[model samples]
Target chain A: MLKVAQPDRPDALTWVFLGLGLLLLPVGLYLALSAPPDVNQGYLARIMYLHVPGAWLGYLAFFVTFLYSLLYLFRQDPRHDRVALASAEIGLVFMGLALVTGMLWARPTWGVYWTWEPRLTTTAILFAVYVGYFLLRGAIEDPELRRKAAAAVGILGFINVPISYMSVKWWRSLHQTQSIDLTTGKIHMDPAMLQALLFNLFVFTLLYLGFVRFRSLLAALEARKEEA
Target chain B: MKLPVEGWPEAAGQGRVGVVRRVVLLALRDLRLEVRDRAGLLSILAFFAVMLFIMALALGPEEEPLRRAAPGVLWVALAFGSTLLSTRAFALEVEEGTLDDLLLAPGGKEWIYFGKLLFQMLLLLPLAALALLMAAGLFYLPLERLFLLFLTLVLGVLGYASVATFYAGLLARLRGREVLLPLLLFSLVVPVVLASVRATTGLAEGLPVAEISDWWQLLLVFDVVYLTASALLFPVVMEG
Candidate 1:
């Protein structure tokens, strides 16, 4: 009979993460909502408070996925694979939120829900690649094979992310003359708005740190079940 | 007349010449197998033809629109066709259990990877020609940019094939990879697809060489990066 390995008990750091996330998120939300709106975009600009932070967290999550994947390949540790899997899952959720929020913001501003804007297009591709990563994980049964394959995808996908972004940028700029695209160049904001955005970014980073701890513990328990 | 083979260190002659020989042998074996079983090649060709016909119909009978859309249509078809080609390359090995045997071979797994990559490139050449012919016939494309178009296709397909072959091998052991391969593969190869379409479009429209150079450079950079990365990573993936 197969035996699952029991996950270790959660320690003080996990509790600390939970406490920080719980305390910071609501305060961050209060600041973001209370901050003055953008002069250019008005009240609608508040979406950026959520959108930008989510997007940053999404990128950060995938970066962690890439790091853990590389470590897994080098060290052949199941723990690294578990950490990679957890971060990728979180990254996908954040990216999906970012995409949706972006679309919502674009609707009133750009006059369309979707545009072939380089950033948007590149993010969509990045999101799809990770979705496929999860699908690949589901398709393989053997633990070692699955981990190796997922790590390969994770690493390659990370490399391709930048290449696709550059290609999209080149493709767009070459085809269309740079007429001051909405997302490019400089953005101006009131100092209060900047502070609010920074606070949210901090909160979201904490949320991600907390979420990954819980998720990895869940993964460890799952691995234990399989082992059992 | 041969000297005692044991006296010669195994590492002496088995350096570059040996790796090259192994790579060539593996590539030829795949190509030979493909030749013997023509179903895979024929199906892909058939798929290419049908895809072109569908594109033709979808764009209607207008020559001007068809001609303008020709570059995009050609590359899109090739991208899908190459997906099928690469997936089949590994799927056959997986089904036949030859993958394990190949992995068991001592050293030179990179040779096996290049072998598959070479096999994919070979199959792509004729398929691309056929697709080009279809585009020319259906879209009424002028042959003025044929040279540039050919170069774009070669580079674009090389980049696309290298990456696709890498993933195909990676996913070959999994169930339901048929669906997952293209999903993951297309996302990663978006750059290759975009560059190819743009470069081909520029050539077809007689854009200045200076303007087209950007696309050419992107394609070249992508091919170099992906090809080298795939070569280095293939051994690790196969070892799994």
Candidate 2:
């Protein structure tokens, strides 16, 4: 009888990256929060440090998923599928973080927990699409078929992201908050504040890479067990 | 490429004719199956009508509110109805294990996808017509812009059927997909639904065609984009 292989431990690189993220996160957070309150919005705008990077990484993770999904179809390798799934899972988590932080940011600024802001609405839809992706994966019993279907879903879902952003933008103009004018591609900020924001963005990106690598290993191990 | 196979004529002629023949035959096959088994059709239409009734009750019988809300309610009912039908779109194939048989016989996977989309559109025809009549009665809609309303329905139905047909095949092999289908489809289909409702509302309000053109254009773009994507991807999904 074939024995099921155990789930692989996160290797040295995973640990190194994760450790760097763990050590740097609080320092980055402190630096981000240390920026002086905005002249117009005051302290409420500080949430941008968390919210912006979270949103950027969220979109980045989905792009990675799309890339791997395309590669999976082309390469016909289960490893690529595993990477796509792991990236999507992490992407969804990042998206959830972005949404919550956005909600928190919106409350004092927009005067409501939610508004039909273009980015917010598009993010909500993105969240739902990936939720459906995981649901699809869970619903299918056959591993090979599930991977193929999921890769297709990943591709389709990514295609919708840009279209959703464009449609929502056309549906309404950017609600120009004090700090960011997404429509004009102009972000007004002091150099120190920008430094803090960029630092957190880097930290979050590294964290995303570490998480996906670890998750993909677990997925690969699971596939090995399934095969056995 | 010349095919030396038995019973097949000129390869170019076969390629050109085969696709149309396959699409029509598959569509007819599905339509015939529906006619033979009217239960699904009747139940789905009944469900649609009842939902409309419930919406009318919920919004109350007042003419002003009903008139303003009519387009949104109508599209909601249509969306729900089409979603119901799509969930069962592949039930027959799954039950009979004939989806594979059809795949094996296909000129291409796209023909099967288009065939199913055509069949769903045919099924929606009477159902949508009845829903339109019901909405007109319940909400006192004007008859002047009937053409635009009908156009919106056609485009809306086309876009919805395209996306829903793809999902139907995707989820056909999964367990508990009946619930999953709507959850996934409704969110992804927001642009189509939003554009349709807005266009219909503008028409109902007697707005000039220019005012509603944005929504109309959005619907057209959505229909073209989704219909093409569904056709291209359907084979990969069904085969996978």
Candidate 3:
């Protein structure tokens, strides 16, 4: 009952997501730039517009990978594995962007590009976990074994996401605590800044959705060509 | 003189205790094999000694620096040593072509995972203690709190081995697994290593139990999570 005849191109929804996300990106940027500066950090805080969304999507993307990986194990479906791979690849890029932007911000704010604080260390470890995920995927030659191994890595490696997210609160270390704490549902920022941040998050999520769909299609094509 | 698989049919009828017995028997069998083999065990021990000696030389000639660097060095040594051991967990099975035989046994496959994990703990704990003693000798690491330090060792090694055993099994049949195992393992076990190091440092620094308890709690959480997650996923991944 495997679905062999799949469409070669991304569907209408993928195009819509990519088109709308790109169209609204400049608007989101304008809002972030015009938003009132933080009382303490001033304009330096604007980087949060990019950094926060990047980190959020990174976490979101990995969570998706984790889910689809589980599904792949249970169902033995190539589509599920492809989705997991695409999500992980996208997650790595976004996580890398977040890390780079963070270092840029930290250089001016914390006097160094990197520090061994809890948040930074956990995030780096999280990044390394996915990098290993890709390495494991690449090293395996058998397709079924590769999918199984990658699924296991995808599931196990997700253990770091929550630890990285909560490291600031747990250690009370150098990193700033979440301004929009998900656990407490607390909003401790100016409304203007919050609005801009939320808009940027929405746009990044749209782009992530489009990217994953497109990447999965590319993966499916590769799989077909390998078979042919 | 029944083969392990020949006994599984009757053992499967025996339920939970049978599973427990199977786990222990499997672990002990592997342990017996490991002890008899000798080379793997001695090489790991020698690896620890040389590692600690070089680390001591690099950070030493001063007790204060050696003492300060002791916890980090000890745990890093243990981490590397365990990777060496973990690959051997399933290496012999694959080489012998008996892995498929083990899989062919009746009932849930989780016991295989637990059995391998137990073997790792049984082997790793003693080696870890010896490594701890070596660190104490060379790096001036304090031994007054030996019990607490050993507790950290158990929790940390369990966490590390749980994932390592799972990966070692997953990659057992693959070529280049020797290079790949550590690359996959070190990232996942960072939290365990970090907490264990912190706990050891606190004990060495003579911190009160209450302060170090936080690290112990973190290690325990990681141990439980890794153990549960690996056991649950092991069967699914190992299946065709």
Candidate number with greatest TM-score? 1
Candidate 3 chain A minimal-lDDT segment of 10 residues: A178-187
Output the better candidate (1/2) by TM-score: 1
Write candidate 1's Cα lDDT for A69-96 as tens digits.
9888788878888889989999999999
Model 1 stretches with alpha carbons more than 4 Å out: A1-7, A177-180, A183-187, B1-12
Q: How many backbone clashes does candidate 2 have?
A: 0
- The residue ranges of model 2 lying beyond 4 angstroms of the native Cα positions read A1-13, A170-188, B1-13
Best by DockQ: 1
Query: In angstroms, how far off is B96's CA in candidate 1?
Result: 2.4
Task: Tell me the tens digit of each residue's lDDT in model 3 across B1-240.
Answer: 012334455655787888899899999999999999999889988987898889888888999999999999999999999999999899889888999989988777889999999999999999899999899899889999888999999989998999999999998988889988998898888777777887898899999999888778877888888888888888876876
Candidate 1 local Cα displacement, residue A189, angstroms: 1.5
TM-score of 2: 0.91
User: Would you estimate the TM-scores of all the predictions?
Assistant: 0.93, 0.91, 0.90
Task: Give the per-residue lDDT of model 2 (tens digit) for B1-240.
Answer: 111234424434576577877778877899899889899888988898889989899997788999988888888999999999886678889988988887666245677788888888888876787889999988776657777888888988988888899999888877898988998788778887777877887787788899888877877887888887777767766763
Model 1 DockQ class: acceptable
